[model samples]
Target: MISKSTIDQVYETARLEEVIGDFVQLKKSGANFKGLSPFTDERTPSFMVSPVKQIWKDFSSGKGGNVVAFLMEHEHFTYPEAIKYLAKKYNIEVEETQRTDEQKQEANERESMYLVSEFARDHFQHNLWESELGKAIGLSYFKERGFEEETIRSFGLGYCLDHWDDFTKAALEAGYQLNYLEKTGLTIIKEGAAEGESNRKFDRFKGRVMFPIHSMSGRVLGFGGRILGNNKKAAKYLNSPESEIYHKSKVLYGIYFAKKAIAKEDNCFLVEGYTDVIQFYQRGIQNVVSSSGTALTPEQIRLINRLTKNITVLFDGDAAGLRASLRGVDLILEQGMNVKICTFPEGEDPDSFAKNNSLEELQHYLQENSKDFIQFKASLLAEESANDPIKRADTIRDIVNSISKIPDTIKREVYIQECAQIMNISEQVLFNTLAQIGQKALSDAGKKAREAQKAFEVVKSEPVQEKIDLQYELERKIIEVLLLYGNEEEEFEDLLLRENEAGDLVLEPESMAAKVYEKIFLDLQEDEIELTHEKFRTIYYLLISSLSENEDFSINTFLTDLDRELVEEVSSILMEEERYTLHQWERKDIYPKEKQAGVSQLVSETILTLRCYLIKKRIHSLQQNTEGSSEDHRETLEEIMNYLQLNTLLNKKLNRVLS
Candidate 1:
């Protein structure tokens, strides 16, 4: 268990915007920050973060909480892991009690795999720096590639021994499980020949250099190993197999290091191999990542999309390789990103180019040589289809197809014009092709929709509309008022029932000054009314207790002690009205009332509305009881009449007419 003081320190030191901003690019909007929903595939910004409250909400997914909750949701971290991450980020020392063997073993499969992978990374690095064979072969290989010691260490480059079972033995001796080792693809286990024989284990990356693949938040997900020797049958580069924690298509190499720089530069430099990414960063270009030699994936693109809308794909001089990589540009375009392509000269890749040139030269080359996708694609294709009318027509259609992938109509049109000039074709021809492709895509989508509809044909009922729960809403409003203005002192009008001189029972209004929470708590207690919603009831009691006990209570600090569900509830209640701020209502000359200006009135109305609702419910129950009971009904009827009069009087005080 982590010490409570450390947890409190983390909550105080970790800024919500700064923590979430590492993963999602956030822009200032009003008093808060808005960004594309990291939880959902969205083009519009709906994820909001309020630094004042230290809470965040994803309107698309309905997930909201404080900083720790965001980490748990986005990074899939355990509670302790999230706190540790924050502690590390904020440079705070974590004071945690040691766990027992059983407690350590109780970690889930995914977490165990992560642990194994991290251990493997450490073991490999130790081999590179400490072991004799590692220093000669692994360390030598990195140095020969012009990677300095710091560069090698920063990327966690390491070497695996030639002996097949050396790593497996070390892991087993360290009390790490062979199950997780094999699951993470660090160790390969084979069954023995005989029943009594033990299973044999081998290091999967034996005789290789290791590169640890990390998640965006810097957890070691897996490894990519490059073979050292020129073995005829062995694959030159190998990656950790798909496991519970590592998915290559979704993971981008160097993202953990490059995320902040990518956001800062407003552009990501895309390369092919691990060395390419490392070399560029070593050359002082920090906003670069690699695809790890895999074909670009939509998931990878979305990862970059979170940081910036611009991507510059760096390619080698190999003609075939360059042509093969063009497909990734279309993927970037489909995600509504601007893509520029840059290629090194013949016999040079990003790794060699960065290694040879100074930082200024490399940066200058990229700026001067990077070409827009339209110009690059059209020029590359025009050379192949020179004086060939049929191939030219196909090339025109191909360019239009790539343009169609762009989501912005203006960008698509602009690219079409550029393609017309490059390919010497009419702009109309490209637009017509674009329209035809779009129509076909729509037709195919419609067909899929109709086929999906066929599966539900037996269910002919219309979707049920949910009726508004007035009591629940009123209860929610009461909680909201208490959370917002609980400690605020205000004058309130108290309604007392008295007999008039004319012999009629009437409401006598009197004035009293009390805190908002005091007024709400007293009003609810006087009526003996409790919130019906379980969540609301629990939070109500907590709020009341907290308000009464602490003279210096803060919602942010109070939220730290609650579980994720309760924290989410409180955040939703507090941020419910913040949605209206996103619309910039004042900019349209439409001024809305501020809740803070009328906290006193808001409290009184919420309590009065709850009283009226409860009274009406009681009257209804009494009326129903009188209908079927054979017992005396006069008392019930009179009780209903009295409740009805009280309900009417409360509603009138609220300026609500009761029918």
Candidate 2:
């Protein structure tokens, strides 16, 4: 655990602009900086960073936060990872609280599993280089696959020894718990052991070359291993079992390495195996990831969706492989992403094809051969159906089903037209089929919604609270004043309403001066008024307490203690007026007044308006209570009249005409 003081130091040392600039190209725009959003592809600059408030907002995606949040969102760093990154950047020595063995043991199960899996990756890599059997067998196998030493190392390729307990023993000797090893499927414990005998545990991937699967942020989540020898009884490839930290359906094999390239190229080359991903990467085609031969899943497609909307699936020319992976195309379409299909020459997989060609030749071939998903599907399925009318009818319906998965109407129509041209079917027929599929989908969705509605009973909504917009607006304005000009002292003329000796109320302008915080606090205290909204009251209390404790208050320092949501709201409030770069009014023959010129009046008027709004609400409440015929009904009527008089006076002071 990082010490609180160290976390504070990191937050203080890291500047929002400087931190976000490392990943985003920002140009100075007035008091803030503007840049293209890193979250999505857009030509316009909508991402804004404010140095004064120490926050950033990506207008395009509605993501905004302090410095630490940007790293977490963009780099996918965890809280500790984000903090450590900042500490390293600012050259701050992090101080950690020393934990006992009991505390260490209390670490969460998922984190422990991650730690164990990472250890396994490192252990296997070490074995590949240092163990005699690993080098002679596993290293030789990778080398024969045309994987260079650097490529093998980059992907964390390694070897597990043939002996059942070799790796498991090494892990136990290294002080790692066997429980985690078993949970990660790195070690398999034999079931149904004989009496008086300890349950036998063996390595899960012994005598296999390893491929470490990483999360988007490059943390080792799991592993895939290929057996070196063709043992007729054993599976050729094996994967880690689903664990707390490893969900096979949710992970793609090489996403960590391919994310940036996918974003840069505006497309991704999705293959099916670890070797295919590695070989393509080695051949300078870095934007490629593999599903590790599993059926394509929606979760995997969403992983690609984060980087780009375009996916080009490379298929082996073999008919069986093509047929097996065809379902994935529909999954991609359902995600609202553009998908293209490319088939290699006969008998060549992506791995073999890339290995045999130069980088230039491979790039050109992919560019020239890739076809729109619908076109490719129709052409391929048409050939397979081949003059069989009933098979061809099924083929058209299959294509229509895939088309129905597309969310865009225009794209579906375009696909239908293309299919009609290729299959010699009417566009109207395809459109009608698509409409029926869509209608059925909507009906199923409606049924699910109804079922869910029944399962979760709908609660009655609470009565609407009557909102006083004027009061709410004034409350927000008061907070804005304190956040912007609280420390500044200025002179202002406040109206004094009094009964002169002439027996009539007279208004007099009285000169007064004080710090904004002092003026606002005294005014609210004298009026006995509190901000009605819970969020506003919380902000007000914190602001007053903070200002009282420190003679000189720093908004940036104050923000470090706030949660991300509050920090964003406060920063947004402070920086709202500065969203568009400050304009040079003088150049346009108009002189603009500085905020300091009106600070005293603004602060004074904001407090006065809030007090006036509160007085009116009190008067209205007392009048309503008088109708209840309580024992104090006459007293309530009197209070209402008194409040009404005060409300009138306050309205006069605010320069509003009586209705």
TM-score of each: 0.96, 0.80
lDDT of 1 at 244: 87
Candidate 2 local lDDT, 251-342, one digit each (tens): 89998888778877879999989999999999999999999888999878877775677999999978786876889999899878899999
**Poorest stretch of ten by lDDT in candidate 1:** 591-600
lDDT of 1 at 533: 96
Global fold similarity of model 2 (TM-score): 0.80
lDDT of each: 0.90, 0.83
- Which numbered prediction scores highest in TM-score against the true structure? 1
lDDT of 2 at 506: 64
lDDT digits (tens) for residues 152-172 of candidate 1 = 999899999999898899988
Cα error of candidate 2 at position 161, Å? 2.2
Positional deviation of 101 in candidate 1, in angstroms? 3.8
Off by over 4 Å in 2: 1-78, 85-103, 446-559, 563-606, 620-639, 652-659
